[model samples]
Every structure is written in structure tokens, then in C-alpha cells.
Target: MEFQGARNFSIESPGNDVFSSKYDDDGHVKRTGTWVTASAHIVTAVIGSGVLSLAWAVAQLGWIVGPTILTVFSAITLVTSFMLSDCYRYPDPVHGSRNPRYMEMVKNVLGGIQCQLCGWAQYIILFGTSIGYTITASISMVAIKRSNCFHKHGHEAKCHAANYPFMIIFAVVEILISQIPDFHELSGLSILAAIMSFGYATIGVGLSIAKIAEGGNHATSLTGVIVGEDVTSQQKLWNTFQAIGNIAFAYGFSMVIVEIQASYLSYPILYYSTQDTLKSSPPENQAMKKATATGISITTLFYMLCGLLGYEAFGNKAPGNFLTGFGFYEPYWLVDIGNVFIVIHLVGAYQVFSQPIFTLVEGWCAKRWPESNFMAKEYHVRIPLVGTYRVNAFRVIWRTLYVILTSVVAILLPFFNSIVGLLGAVSFWPLTVYFPTEMYLVRAKVPKFSVIWIGVKLLSGFCLIVTLVAAAGSIEGIITDLKTYDPFN
Candidate 1:
């Protein structure tokens, strides 16, 4: 369908002149994305490394609180996502100018120092997520090798593997994928990553079911791991906080929702030939809300399955990452396959989270030095099978260094659960709850001191407390891990 104000332009036209007619009303390349592609992108970003930790989260919270917390977080995520989606366009959700990035939306809607705060929260979360994904990817890679070794030898075999080498390998892969340009070019990769996410998640659920059917009993209770027997009182409190953080991490795709909603491909000229008779595509906010609902529904289902079934199968002993943590070892091949899917999904996910940061830095540099060819120049290199490729010196160097830096960080502190918890705790309140709620209040013109306003503020306040406790727990856990851990060993 053609956009309402879209102009018909010949596709053969060359140079910048084509941009005026070929682009959308906001000067972006025409957005061809529907709710389906949007949902794919959401699923790819949301159902990632965080899902692997849900089993452990559940083990800490126990069966009742575990499922309840997961459901509550899912509901919170859905509400906040809908709020953020509406903010994609400015004054009017339907007709206002587009705010393609999250910070852009914050700047336009909230303005002032709020934008700077949003930038720090958003970019730090994105950067930390890249590191977390790197750590998780290397873990999965090591899991595959160890799984094979266990099958060849026995469960008693050491089968030890170093995560550093695999981390470097994963970083190299990300450095290559990082050059893909922007969110507009990530549709295919996101779709593939979404599928891979489902693959491993399904494998994890299936293995959990198999293990449960085997009828072996495990230690379990309504209150989770016993404080006196399994852990100390302080440890219990800390673990509960970390569990909350893990759940928070699993539901955090809100930061990128604006970017995903803004992603659009150019429509073919043939289809737009009869522009007068064509209808505009569905409004972006509407599409994003639908995608959020669908994606969250699908992910929450998998999360419940993975977390609940995994808990039932392994009880309080559930590993942080059920698949790679060797919770299911007999079907070693299936475990290996699951790890492979994790690696592939993370490769795509790393790009999804990193692209916005790349855009922000690169955009800032270009604006700062418009005359610098080193920052703005594009070198075209054509391979036989592939079409012409645009290579920028600054992009190549900056993104490569960024990947390397994250890789080194992952190597230095390779605690997966703690890192995920810390990132989630740091980002969840500000990015997920507070920003969206405040933005919605301003954009929707919610009356001051009204019931809705008070309720949202209360929600935000409660989440702030959660963030504090979760951050504390994650930090404590990291400190504990570091005591026995040797960096880069």
C-alpha cells in the first residue's frame, strides 16, 4: 500500500534527487514493515540470552512466586511497550513527525536533561547487553565442545574448556556483522535470529519434559531453595533480588521498540503506480503495539515453559542457563544443537543491540566533522556474488574497537547470571518503566494528580525500589564470584 502523502517517483532516477520522491514523508526510506516483521524483530531482541537464565530465576523464587513474577513482568512489559510505541510519532501518534530513535523521542517529547539521561541509560544498557551476549555466546560454544567430550568420555570427565578463546571468536563474528549499516538492513537477520531463539527454547522445553517424565524426584519447596540448608539467609535475599533482575532482563526490548517501529523498506514502484487509489500502511504505533502484544505473548509462553518445566525437572538445582549449564546431558547431540542455535541467535542479537549505539556515535561524528572524508567517505567494494558494498574507514575502525572492548570486558568478568542481572537492574527502571511512563504522561496529556497518573507513578516508584535491590544483589553476587574467579584464565 502507498503512504497517504507519498509521491510517485521513477525508480531509475539516480543520485540524491530520488530521495525526495522515493522516501517516506519523514525523509526516511519507505517503511515496508508490517506487524509481522516488527514482531520478528521484537522476538529476536526480547527472547535472547536472558531466557536462558529464567530457570535459575525460577529456582530462586520457587514455583508459586516464580510463575507469578514472570507473569507480572510480562504484563508490565506489555503495558510499557504500548506506551513507548505510541511515542514513536510526536504530537499525534498517527500523523506527527517520526522520532526514529528512542533518544530522539525523549528529546522531542520530554526535552532537556531528560534526553541526556535517557541516552546514558539506553546506550549503557545496549553496550552492556552486547557484552552479556558475548559472554553467553562463548558459554554456548564451550557447552557444545564439552557436551561432545562428555558423550565421548563420561559425565565424570573433566571436559574443561576456556571461554576466552570462544569469546574472541564470537567478537570477531560480531565485528563482521556489525557493518550491516542499520535497523533497516536487519530484517532478514532478525527473522533468522527469531527462528533460532525458538529452536533452542523449544529444545530446552522438550528436554525439560523428558527429564520430568523420567520420574526422578528433586528437592523443591514453595519458598524455593531452603535458606538454612541450600543457602544462608543473606544469600537467599540476594538471590531473590537477582532473580527479579533476571526476569527484568528477559522483558527488556522496550529500549529498541522505537527503532524497530521506525524500520521500513522501500516499496516497489509497480505497486505504487496507482497511488491515488492506494491506502496508507497501518500507522506505525498501531503496528508496533500489535507486534508487542504478539511477541510478548509468544515469549512469555516459552518463558513459562522453560522456567516452570525446568524448575520441575531440576528443582532448586536448576542451572543459570539450563541448556548450556548441562541440565540435560544424556541427549548430548540435542544439547549441542541447542547450543549451536544459541550461538547463531546471539550473533544476530549482538548486532540488533549494537546498531543503535553505532548509529549514535557515527551520526555524532559526521555532524561534528562534516568536512572530514575520513569520517564521511564510503568506499564501494563489489564481490562476485554480493552486490556493491559500502565500506567506511571510521565505521570499520570504531565498530571493530567497540567489539574488541566488549570482548575484553566479557573475558574479565564472565559471570553470566550476575552480568545479566546487573545490566537488567541498571536499565529496567529507567529505560523500561520510568522513561516510557513519563513520556506517555506528557504525550497523552494525562491530567496531573489523576488516578491514572498516580497509578503510573506508583508503578514507577515500585520499580525503582526493585532496581535498587536488584542492583545490590547483582553487585554482591559479582563480588562473591570474583573472589574465586581468575580473569582471563
Candidate 2:
């Protein structure tokens, strides 16, 4: 189904006063949604399980360095997001020349195998990052319960699995639920997404604040809490650098090629609704710049708030839990009450991740399912997701399945070292630092540092290195502990 030919719908665009771009019978944009509630898309995409690590690092780096990362990122994002806002700048699609997308943009600017390879590489990282998050969220869920349960029962078989049931149930439920089609419009998912993000931040803030306010009792000594005090000076220096890097990485200013297109009068609808919005958006500097700017602002706000609050509560010698993190310390209760919300959050994340492919699927579906009732407004409403999905559903289905399976892995994997390593190296480094810039580089020919793209990559690299080293140290100690002590296994 080629959705490209379908008449452009006006309801989904960000420029809509109400934020709901739904069109009317005459194809007029809907004026209904007046932004009643704040959204979490900004929060969800930016802040995740990485907050704990970021929070800890913030404390180590002090209020200055930590906040600096966040503030700098926010400033950069503000520019990027506004530029993204300008993607609508071309007097709207109803007026004139539309923008091109990642492939098109890169093809236009830096055509060749490199951009193509980058396109493919970025798809992997973006989808992989999504998978990693799903895995981490699931793992945290089970681990939190198990950690608490084990502390009491001593790792008995009854509760040995740690959220095993939730994993099975959650994945199946999400799968079935996802099949139900949109709960109406993209905004619905946006709401769900916002909650998950807010929930994560809320919990972390609550825990950190509780611990910090309590003072002393919840605070763990730096050396003691981190676990390896007497490592070589190089390692120690490296660890400190890692902490700084995490801060920098969290400063998420990137040259986003995707959001820019959204602001463009001619950006493909798939860009906003696709499985890979970043990669799928128009690639021109105007488009890319706009996307990066939007990403920078929304993401920066989320990261900065999370960092500030997380640091407040968890920073500097503090050990506490966040909402999602709470599921780690107190699972059943947290899951029982928050799971519904958490489920929403996961769905939100899934939808956002699925967009890259979904948009493509939607695009294909449109081509395949040519509008029988062109005048029918529903055609406009459904076309994007279907079009993109049709183009990429097979991939989406597998990635979705992969996400679920990996989440299940989270339930089973429990080595502190592995967790830290994954959290730091696998999760934090890539998404925060590596992914943004590397992905953007596909279209970013000259790669200017002044651009958020440069900042994101530079910062991500800085963070990735530090996080990996710290994780490596922690993992090594765990290996040694297992060999010598063998506490339970």
C-alpha cells in the first residue's frame, strides 16, 4: 500500500493549536484537543532506567558538572526543537514544496554506500536501543521483586524467578493489546507515553528525595556503595571520567534529521508516524535541523528534570528507588498499582519504537489498501501507521517479539556486574551518546560540533567510555566474588 499518494491529513501535525491534527469531513483539521494534559513523550524518550546511573554520577560530579550536562543539552535541544517546529515553516503542505526524508536527504547530500550503510546501522541502533530499554524495564521489574524477595527468603525456588509471571503475562498482553489498533489517535499513545516518563521521574525523585531528606541513613559511602575502592589509579581516574561522561552523554543535544522534516511543509507523514522517525524524516539541514532542535528541547527538559530530581534524591552517597525502580525494591505492590500505568508506558515505548517500522508499514498499507472511500476521513486517520507498517511490519513484529524476549531475559539475568555493564555500556552509552550523533551522521556530512549532532556524539562517546570502564570494574569484581565466595549459586 503506497500511502504517499493519499491526501495529506492535517490533524497529526504539531502546529495544530489543539495539538490534535485530526481532519474533518471536508479534510479540515480538527480543532478539538486543547492540550489539557502535559505529555510524557518528551520524558519517556529522554529519561529511562539510566537515571539511576545518571543520578549517581551527578552526585559524584557535583551539582555543577551534572546540571551542566543537562542544561547544555536543554539549550541545544531548544534550538533543535524550534527548528523542528519550523519544519512546518514552509507554509504547510497545503501550500508548497515538501521536505525529503533521511534516505532522500542523505541521498541528496552525501549519496553513496556510507549514508546507506549509516541508514542501516542507525536502524539497528534505534531498534536495538528500544529492545534494550524493554529488556531493562522488564529486568528491573523482576529483579526489584527478586532482590526484595531474596533478602527475606534467601533465594528459595518459590520466588526464584523474580517477575517471571509478569514477563510472560506482560508480553502476551501487550501483543494482544497492540493488535487492537489505535485507541483512537496518536495522541492516545502520547498520553500513555507521557505517564510512563513522568512515572519514572516521579519514582526516582520520590526515592531520592526521601533518602536525601532523611539524610545520612540512606546515603552510602562512595567507595562502599560503588564496591571497588582500591582499584589501580588508572581505573579510579577512568571511573571518575566515566561519571563525567555520563553527565555529558545525558546532555542530549543532537542534530536530528527527523524532527526537522516534521516542521517542513513537505515532510512525509511517515516521518512523524514511522517506526524510525529519526531515520525516516526528511534529511535536509532544514529538516534535520528542525528535528534535532525539537529532540534537543523535549529531551533536554526531560533529562534535566530527571537529573535534577534524581540527583536531589539519589545523587551523592544516596541509594534509593524511583517509580520504575521501586518495582525493583518492591515489585508486587508497585507492579500491582503501577503496572497498569507501567503497561501503558511500555505500550507507549513500544509504539514510539514501532513508529520507525510502523510508519513504513503504514506507508505500504496505504499503497496496498488504496483508499476505497477517499472522501472518508478515517482513511486519513489510519493511513500513516498502516502505510509505514506495511513497509516494515515483518521487521516490527520480530523487533517487538525480540523486545519481549529480551525483557524476559531481564527477569532471568541478575549479576550485578552484568546489570551495571548493560546499564552503563549497552544501554546508556549507545542511546544517550552514540546513537543520536551516529544516527544523525548519516545525513550530517560535515559534522559540525556547534550542531547538536556534534554535541550528542561527543558527549555520548565521552559517557560511553566512562560507563563501560566503570561497568567493567564492577563486573570483574563480581566475577571474582562469584569464584571465591559463591554466595548462593
Candidate 3:
């Protein structure tokens, strides 16, 4: 369904005053990020190591269907992002109030039960995502080390891809980085992450071009593009929908949009910025639409290039990960460099995605234990212009423990592609399809069961069915994979 940017309408409820947005003194928009920064944030948050799997995902669909799936999902995500953007404004202009958190927005529209469920799902999905990043980072380090060893010893190199040491190292680094107070604080990192994403995409594309030039056309056409005789009907069906799920996962960033927008607006109108800032000098709607469009378009191009090239290069034999599949070429420095870029990019991305969870959990804790020391304000050291943040001992302890836990889980499971698929299945419908559409309907007061409303419901139901099937397949795949690898190996 097409969502218009101009149709943003406010909703008023008597007890909605509890929702608030934060602002700076003098009420100017305190955290107004430039379009460049917002674009960077979107790129960093959306394009994780997930793109490394796109070639394999599309390989399941062949050249014809693969690109179609990528383009279709990209448009869907862009439309949902617009639906979400409209909700960032205040429900009541006079109160100048806004819901800065996704959970808050869900609570405002769908009521408390759904809001609680959304909060749970959001944190779980984000945490699962962080685990996927940790696995990717660890595996990338392993690939780099293997490449370096092979360069020195040729066929005699005995390189192992162990998860524990690198997982520990990655976890420690993430623990240090995840301590950043807010999204705006991590803008510089986001920019670097964007650059790193581009670096990896370039490497993937360049290598694919080189491989094709070398006549590396050793691929079986199991994807039903050229001929359907190579595989059974069941195999084709499974791979086709599996490919759809992977594409959906690749575009699953809707849950984090509200948090990213928070960086642009500082806080919503309720917290600090005035209604004048919202009505008069606020960031232009078109500017944000452009930013969102530019970021997603660039990402879609990169994903398609990597998917098409990798599929054409390796065909049905394409490895689950594009970079890992490159291991057949010995002593390739480009492979090492690309893997390093992946590690760096995932590190930055882990923060971009995890910070929202941190914000929501901390806010929940502060409210739940108002009288406890866990909620008490304390002093933190200054970081230049950031000034001394009012630190809480609980924050340092809890967020650290949380990172450690996710790291441990990654080390234990280390099921990279499967975990990503699972998380994507869980998030795609609620965060991407259902919640945004439902909330928009609520905000716009479109009558229930009308043509538009029934159409939305039917669409949402279809999405949920597809995702459920996807989740089941992903779970089964993980079970099969688990039999092949022991924990921490």
C-alpha cells in the first residue's frame, strides 16, 4: 500500500501526557542531524553482514527471480519507512509531545498489550541481530588469519577457524563501543561504518568481475532460471520462498527507524523542541524521504550486484557467505581486506542497532525501580563536547553484562546465516509490515474493514504466513547445522 507523506494527522487521548520528548535549552532542535548523517545512519543500520548472504539467497531464485525479489522488498521497506516517519510527529500539537521510542509509538496506536509485545520482540530481535554481527566479526577474523597463514605457508598452512578467541575479542571491543550514550553520539562511527559497507560491496563486485573474466563459470543451474529439469518441484518451492525470506531479512531495519530518527530530531516535540520547530523550521519531509530513498537505493544496487555477480560466478554451488566462498582462491589479499572491512562494518552496525535496545531497557529500568540505587544519577567522565553525562552505575554494569551474554551466545551457537534468517523471520512481519500499516490506519482514522483497511489486513496476513513458513525453515536449517559444529568451535 502507498503511504503519503502529507497525510500525517495527530491523535489525542486524555492520558497521553506521560509520553515525552527531550530538548535542549532555548528549545532549538538539539539533535538535528544533517541529511548526510541520517543517510549514513540508515546505511550503517540496514546493511549489515547480511548482504554477504544475498548471493546465496538469490542463487536460490536464479537471475530472473532473484533481482525481482530484491527490488520488490526494497520498495516495500521504503514504503514502510514512510509510514513510520509520519508517526514521529506529535499526536497533539499543543502539548508539543512526541513518542521517541518505537514501543511508545506502538503503545500510542495499538494499546498497551501490543506495545509490551513489541518491546519484547524489538529487544529480542535486536539482541539476536547483535549475535549475528558477533558471529560474522569472529568468522571474518578467522578468514583473515587463514588467508595470512596461507600466504606464508602455501598448501602447508594449518589454519583453524576458531570462534572463542575472536568472539571474546569482538565482544570486548563491542562492550567498549556500545557504551556511547546515544545515537547522535555515534554519528561519526556511523559515517565510518557507511564507508566500510561501501568498501566491502566494492570488493565483492570487483572480485565477481575478475572471477567472471577468468571464466570461472563453474555453477549448476538449480535455480530454475535457465531450465527446471535440474531440481525437484519441492526443491524449487523451498528455495524460492527461502530466497524471499532472506531478501526480507536483508531489508529488515524498520524496528530501528524510530531510534535513528531520534538522532535527527534530538527528542520528539513533547520533550524539548517547540511546536514552532515542528511546524516552521523542522527538517523537511522531502529531505528525509530523499535520505531514506538514497540510502535504500544504494543498498539495493549493491545487494543486487553482489547477488547477481556471485550467482553468475558460482551458480548453485555458491557458498552461504560470499566472502567465505572466496576461500577457494589462495593467498588473496583482496579477500583478507574485504573480510577486515566486514568486521569493522559489523562492529559499527552492532552499536547502531543495539543502542536503541539500550535506551529502551534503561528507560524501563529507571521507571520500574525509581527508588532504587539502580536508577540513581551518578557522574561520568567527560568526552570533549559531549560533556559529563550523568552516569548510572547500573548502566555500565547492565549494558556490559548484556553484551557479554550476547557474545557468549554467539560463541555457543555461532550459526551465522541461520540466526540471521531466524531473526529476520521474527522481525519482518511485525516491525516491517504489520505495525507500521496498522499504526498509520489508526493515526489517519481510516474506518475499519473499509477497502483500504481490509486490503491492509489481507496483506498483513499474507506476510505473516510467509514469514511463519520462513521461520520454520530457518529453524530446521539451524538444527541441521548444529549437528555439524560443536559449541565454541
**How many steric overlaps are in each model, in order?**
2, 70, 3
Q: In candidate 2, what are the lDDT values of residues 1-489, reduced to their tens digit?
A: 112223763344454445423432334333231111111223334554445456555544456656665565455445433333333212242232233344443344335664565456445544544454454445455555655665567545356444446556556655644543332345555555556656755655555455456654344332322335434555445445455444433442222333221321123222431112222224223333443445455666556656566656543443322343443343345433443454556665555554565455555666776663332123112455454222234443544665576555444443322344333443344433343344345433435655765665666566556556755654554454456543223
lDDT of 3 by residue, 12-66 (tens): 4542343213333223334445556656656655666778888888777876777
Q: Rank the candidates by TM-score, best first.
A: 1, 3, 2
RMSD of each: 5.5, 9.8, 7.3
Error of 3 at 479 (Å): 0.8
Per-residue lDDT tens digits for candidate 1, residues 1-489, read: 333333563333355466655566543466566678777656655666778899899999997899999998889888998898788777898878666667777899999699999878877887998899999999999999998898888888888888999999998888888876666666777667768988898898898898889888778789899988989999999999999999898887665465544332221111111111111367777777887899899889988988888888888988888888652378898899899999998897788778768887999999999999999899998978978778999999999999999999999899898999999899889988999999999999999999999999999999899899989999999999999997766
RMSD of 3: 7.3
True lDDT of residue 249, candidate 2: 35
Candidate 3 — which residues are off by over 4 angstroms? 1-26, 30-41, 90-100, 155-158, 178-188, 220-241, 261-287, 361-396
Give the candidates in order of lDDT, highest first.
Answer: 1, 3, 2
Using TM-score as the measure, name the better of candidate 1 and candidate 2: 1
